[model samples]
Target: MTETPNLKIPHGGYVVVGDGRRALVLRNEGHALHLALRVQHVFEAPPNPPTREQGTDRPPRVRQGEHRSAIEQTDWHTIAEERFADEVAAALDRIADAIPALIVVAPPRTLASLRQALSERLKRVVIAEIDKDLTKLSIEEIGRRLTDG
Candidate 1:
């Protein structure tokens, strides 16, 4: 009797999406080809505040006790952006460590930004950009697209 080849693909990497509140970690290699609602992580975005002039007429000051908390609650948008990028970058880094090739299909803008932020080593990997929101799609549909491609 012939044995069936264990075409099991290893964990390719994690897929980080959403506004950091919702993300997916696709471990198994064929996961992207087999996941329906690809959400595995949900985290609150970090807090960031805008920078003020270094030497202002009146230097900014805050009570010691309130300083920490106050500073933490400033620019939410910047905080979210940084945190999201950091999380995604970390996931992609792990993926790069595992394989010689990786195909990243995200919105064109996101793909461009991520491509620029990747390390030199990661840049060596095969990165493809596709404008599709995979979070809403099913594994079967994704598989069909892959096979068709």
Candidate 2:
């Protein structure tokens, strides 16, 4: 496992813990040695069923003369995740300037979605990006992970 660099989140910096469904925005009031992370905002998306559960019908088949082709079914679950990431980015953009620095923690796919959704200006302020699903972690645990090796 690659050790994450010890993060000294500055005052007013944000640590966004998220996955495909929800995001917890935490702000650091204290410095590197004594980190105090307070949840500033919480964003949650509507629950989505699995792709198979969502799609009731089978994939449609097209026939051209003697040739037949089957098209891939749409992945509803993935689409929902991408949309949620966009919503999260928009929420952050509203207070983009207020955030002096940002630390994003999400699953790999969600992280990629957030990367695309974030505004260019907001992207510049990002200090670290951890490809892990950290939304389930408690506030104190998240703080320890950010600071401790």
Candidate 3:
């Protein structure tokens, strides 16, 4: 009879945990995980302008009594988050070949953004994805959570 391979065993690979604000890159070392890098999004926080800026100039009114309106102001927070995701994706792309596998952990929205930002090649290496913000967790706690879950 053929034996089935054990699926519960964790493979050596990279573990990435983050939100839009910060990220942690960890690699499996023997049976333990070690931090390889930390990435922080300096622009994740919204800028503090001296005062609220005025909206874009209104569209010129037509002579026929109707007028077009400008689009709503940009959502800077969402933009920053997406930019952060792109940064993470680029970082992953650079190291994808070095890692045997990959596990991603992030908040739901950030995870979606990161998934969208990753290249198709990088996407193939992802072994698991946990939708939780673990960027703030300690290395030990993160390791435990990864193993327990």
Candidate 3 lDDT, 108-139, residue by residue in tens: 89888988998888888777777888777787
**1 or 2, greater by lDDT:** 2
Candidate 1 vs candidate 3: the TM-score winner is 3
Clashes of each: 2, 0, 0
Give candidate 2 regions above 4 Å deviation: 1-3
Write the number of the candidate with greater lDDT, choosing between 2 and 3: 2
What TM-score would candidate 1 get against the native?
Answer: 0.48
lDDT of each: 0.46, 0.87, 0.67
TM-score, every prediction: 0.48, 0.92, 0.70
Instruction: Please state the error at residue 109 of candidate 2 in Å.
Output: 0.4
Between prediction 1 and prediction 3, which has the larger lDDT?
3
Ranking by TM-score: 2, 3, 1
lDDT of candidate 3 vs native? 0.67
lDDT of 3 at 81: 80
Question: Any residue pairs clashing in model 3, and if so which?
Answer: none
- Which tens-of-lDDT digit does each residue in 74-104 have in candidate 2? 9998899899999989999999989998888
The better-scoring model by TM-score among 2 and 3 is 2
Summarize candidate 1's per-residue lDDT along 4-36 as a digit string, tens digits. 122222245433333333334333345543533
